[model samples]
Target: MKIRILRVFAAVLLLSFALPSVAQNVRYEQQGTAYVTAEDQWIADRLVDQAIGAPQGADAQVVFYRTHDQVPGPVRVDGGAGPLALLESGTCVALRLVPGSHAFVIDGRTVTVRVEPGERDYVRITSAPTGPKVAISNALTFLRLVTGKRDPLYASN
Candidate 1:
């Protein structure tokens, strides 16, 4: 009985450590007017540096993914340019933003994102009952999208 109890305790202890590590892998933060994860920050920095002689302008790269399968239709981004569509679930697209403050209407929600020269910003769009929602993607979701991995965002459906 003691041996069985020890084994059960060991299993629980192992899981206690494992679960938090998994949770820690994804984190979110609000940077300026945009929401971003630590991974997004790194990716944006790299992309910005790679742009050869890219003009010093407030630039933004937006990623839109479906969080709920029940959402009706695709989410749309309008303003600061043309209307960009996010078709299908788990689909992601990048948008280029010009410097200064720009108002973008996602679905039916209007969110104002500010971009500063020489800096790259990120935003994420998700589904909501009222309409589409905009926020920053967590590290795990962003990494899965960028790495072409099977994302849980669509797998739950």
Candidate 2:
């Protein structure tokens, strides 16, 4: 039991250090739903467009993934216009965002994210009281899983 516990601890520790010295300086681009948001067709197809590799042109990629499995029901992700994708646990969805500040609408709250040119960012969503909360990760544990060469990452979670 001790060995198994140690292995689990090691895995979490390794994941925590995957980004090494990445400075987690998160910039929120919106405040209190006051910004215009993009309309994603998440419900029409039940999933967002999956991005396996780096984005093209001058856009940056943002991958959204859930952090926990406590929420048994699917979380509804919508845009300003209409319904978006329903997020399930353990799935990764990638979006090619233009190089600028963008707002992510979740759980009736808005989280702002700034995208840099030719850079890739990860968003980890967790359940919160009012709604789902999001944060930027400085680790590649999920990045690798999203961009894994062998397994194609889709909009599952």
Candidate 3:
């Protein structure tokens, strides 16, 4: 019994030290504007950087996709969650999205796509002149963009 107890203690000690590295998991999900305040954007950006291996104070990958409808029309698509990989807030989680099609609505169209971990993906905004742009904001600006209502980055003086 004493030997078994000692082995369990050693295993606990090993896990205690191993947990921090395991905490590095990334949770990726599309943040709903309704549920997220502007400040959350900063947090989201930070999480994205960490997901792509940038971690805090480092740069990461961010990409955007635009699409024009085969025929002229409003760009519309429904995009929120999918089977693709995503890193999200609340929990530092790393997992593949649910295995299936997810709808993304933007502009005025609809798109069905799959999402997974590390699969940086986006809804194709067809028939739109421009799609959402993804840019890296330094820590300060990133915070301001989230906390401030007006986009200081694009405000006209």
Candidate 4:
């Protein structure tokens, strides 16, 4: 009986520690083509809604968007060379990369993408039970997001 109780207690303690690493629930509001955190929407409203176009003669454009899930705390995004952007839930960031292979590390999740010249790539961040799942998306999918096919949501932690 004592051994069973000890095992159960150990399991609970382990789960408690692991919970922080899991994806955090957050609320978001749509602002033009971007989704910004409801709590801090003002800060991102102007930046995301502005007519930020791809730079002239850029090789490729990559947009990392998190519309569904929120990341815990302020996570620094490492774009191979170094920390390039600070990301949180309900925020999106864009990068222009030379036509080549690159790896972007966000919240400890590494996603590798091959960028083609004059092409645009999209990545979506979704919430999972374990953590955030990063997947590559296409222009059509991003279009759906922009066209209001997908609905914005929030979850309570």
Candidate 5:
């Protein structure tokens, strides 16, 4: 009986560590864009109503790409009326924003983007000589390489 209890306790402890990793893997799919986690989806939905509220046709689209670098830390997004979402290198997140100007604070740097209806915008976060920087670009080629044949919004942690 004591051995059984010990085994159960061990299992519970092991699960506690494993559960966080599992939760991190849960991807929120929306309109061919994928949020890294359910919380990310919820926060984005709240900040930009069109993200998941509309069946189709977002007011605007924004893609954030975390460039591959030697940096070992995750970049976090702040401001823009949404909760923070941590981004790791080699991963990207696409956001649907309401038509307007929104500023996002990433890695302690501010990136302001103007969203126009029916427009697709892209931002890349890279390690710059000064530090981390966000730049606007046409990410079609990069997206194609990372997304492949899979749904444009599909992502896995």
Candidate 6:
């Protein structure tokens, strides 16, 4: 009886280890202009798997490519909104991520976005204020003003 029980346990362990290999793999596809926002933001994301919530491990990262040309410092993500991290680039931001919807706020500009597994979503953010003006402004003050603005894209959700 003891031998029989041990065999059953070993089989169960083997099956547990094997099952994950049968699980689905993430697939990516390049979306045409179909996914772009009304503001002309082009978004590229994965097609495989339902929306991932969060990934495990420290190596998982979300990279933000900011084509907007401004790298906001001391960036932060709203924890209540979703799981996301912020990385700085000269013009792009990289995020260490899981999968799911996220709100990316930089230089006080917020983009409410979603991510898929095994895919890099490239978006051209279009809500930026136009007409560049040269003026001396406090970085802290600017940060406060921009961050304080409740993101319309996020607030409605």
Name the candidate that leads on TM-score: 4
C-alpha TM-scores of all predictions: 0.49, 0.52, 0.23, 0.54, 0.52, 0.29
Tens digits of per-residue lDDT, candidate 3, 58-99, equal 222223233223434322223464333222211112223344
Model 6 segments more than 4 A misplaced: 1-61, 68-89, 125-157
TM-score for candidate 2, residues paired by index: 0.52
Could you tell me the lDDT of residue 106 within candidate 1? 78
Clashes of 4: 0
Global local distance difference test of model 3: 0.39
Instruction: Tell me the whole-model lDDT of each prediction, alpha carbons only.
Output: 0.58, 0.59, 0.39, 0.63, 0.65, 0.38
lDDT of 1 by residue, 44-88 (tens): 445434542233455544444555457777777777566876555
Better of 1 and 4 by TM-score: 4
| Better-scoring candidate (TM-score), 1 or 6 | 1
Summed backbone clashes in each candidate are 0, 4, 31, 0, 0, 9
Clashing pairs in 1: none
RMSD of each: 10.7, 16.7, 18.1, 19.6, 14.3, 17.6
TM-score of 4: 0.54
Q: How accurate is candidate 6 locally (lDDT)?
A: 0.38
- How big is the positional error of residue 17 in model 3, measured in Å on the Cα after superposition? 49
Reference-based lDDT, residue 98, model 2: 80
lDDT for each residue of candidate 5 in 59-136, tens digit (9 for 90 to 100): 687777787777877888776576556778777777777878889988778999887886666678886556688887
Clashing pairs in 2: 42-84, 42-85, 43-84, 91-157
Candidate 2, 19: how far from true, in Å? 28
Which 10-residue window of candidate 3 scores lowest in summed lDDT? 86-95
| 61 Cα displacement, candidate 6 (Å) | 5.2
